[model samples]
Target: MTRPLLDQARIHPAALAQIGSYHTDLIAEVEAAVAANKVVVVGMGLNPFPAKARKILDGQGTPYKYLSYGNYFSQWRPRLALKLWSGWATFPLIFVNGTLIGGATDLQKLIASGEFVRLLG
Candidate 1:
């Protein structure tokens, strides 16, 4: 499952460092959460999906760490860095046991299949 990204070699040497460092702090924050928690949900305000994901976790009695960056009106740049870093296009980027399991729908499927608990173990 390879997603197409611009070849790094095609990027000018002068821009590589800048590109690599863009919103690094935000990425680092999410990384830290993912590392420390069994389940981490990276989301933004004003979005129902993240909340939906949380509700699902709650219903299942699953404890998770959530990292919300910004809403529809603010802090889009930091969220963009998260999207680029995770290769997930939407909010509520869910990580289980340090691996990205995708968003709410994906989480639901995992729960339905009883894989979510397995992942936690």
Candidate 2:
């Protein structure tokens, strides 16, 4: 049988510590968000993607935590590892029900297709 979508990507805490570049609190938040039933969106400022993501969650009456790095270049100063971890070069790195469902465009597709609502269930 196929694995559930919510069970797809897991945030390994020890692995994050091994990287040792990001702040402990940030890692803890990421880990916590991944383990929650709600949505989590990590992005930088001045990006439409993150805002778009928040809108989607708002429309569905879903609550999400939005994390930002202020700017794209600022992200590389300390969030390069996070970019590597999420494997996305964009602004919003979204997660839902402990799964990294991807960014705005990806989330939009899911919302449009009605997969997002189903996924949350």
Candidate 3:
């Protein structure tokens, strides 16, 4: 399933470079973690959802790498970059084996259905 994005042609050439480089360092950090780890959860501080996701993983004895950014009171710009880059629009972006598996509720469903374990394998 492909998420629709603005056509590059629709964007001005001069702005493309800036858009490509926008907060790329943060995105690269998450990318590197996802590449190296079997499971990765990208989340922010002060958010219970990320913690909940972690707890679920813990319950399953699943070791995962977690990357936390700033909380509600700070660092929204950097977080925005993550949202735009991932197109997930929420915290605790969970990735399993280099594929995004959504957030906590989604994770729980996957686990209950046995797909989560299958994914790890």
Candidate 4:
């Protein structure tokens, strides 16, 4: 059988550094949340930031949701719709604790700064 991602029930050092620099307290908080059986949601698309974020979350065993239309929709289409109606599509929208993070870059910054982990709790 393969070894679990979290061996010895602890996070890997390199991964910890990537995620720990942002929020020193985040690891503890996430551990607590998981122990409590709370749900954490991650919303992202196929963009670079989302892809990176998903990678981190996967290692952490955190759950997330993906939202992307891929190459099927163009930016101007929203404008076209607005001319006909008043609706449009947006990007980098991430919601956690009922707050939106705007995009993957923002999440990367947050994770780097350590805020992402604290919020998981």
Candidate that scores best on TM-score: 1
Relative to the true structure, how large is the alpha-carbon lDDT of every model?
Answer: 0.94, 0.74, 0.94, 0.48
lDDT string, candidate 1, 59-99, tens digits:
98999998998899999998999998989999999999999
Count of clashes, each model: 0, 0, 0, 6
Off by over 4 Å in 2: 1-25
* Total colliding residue pairs, candidate 3: 0
For model 4 the local lDDT of residue 19 reads 40
RMSD to native for every prediction? 0.9, 7.0, 1.0, 18.5
The TM-scores of all predictions, comma-separated, are 0.97, 0.72, 0.95, 0.43
Q: Model 3 — which ten-residue stretch has the worst lDDT?
A: 1-10
Q: Across residues 18-56, which tens digit of lDDT does each residue of candidate 2 receive?
A: 655555566677778778647889887777878888887
Score candidate 4 by TM-score against the native.
Answer: 0.43
Error of 3 at 108 (Å): 0.3
lDDT of 4 by residue, 40-82 (tens): 3322333465566566667767776544333324443332322
What is candidate 3's lDDT per residue for 1-121, written digit by digit as tens?
4999999999998899989999999999999999999999999999999999999999999999999999999989999998998889888899999999999999999999999999998
Q: Show pairs that collide, candidate 4.
A: 22-112, 22-113, 22-114, 23-114, 92-102, 92-103
Error of 2 at 13 (Å): 21
Greater-TM-score candidate between 2 and 3: 3
Point out where model 4 deviates above 4 Å. Answer: 1-46, 72-90
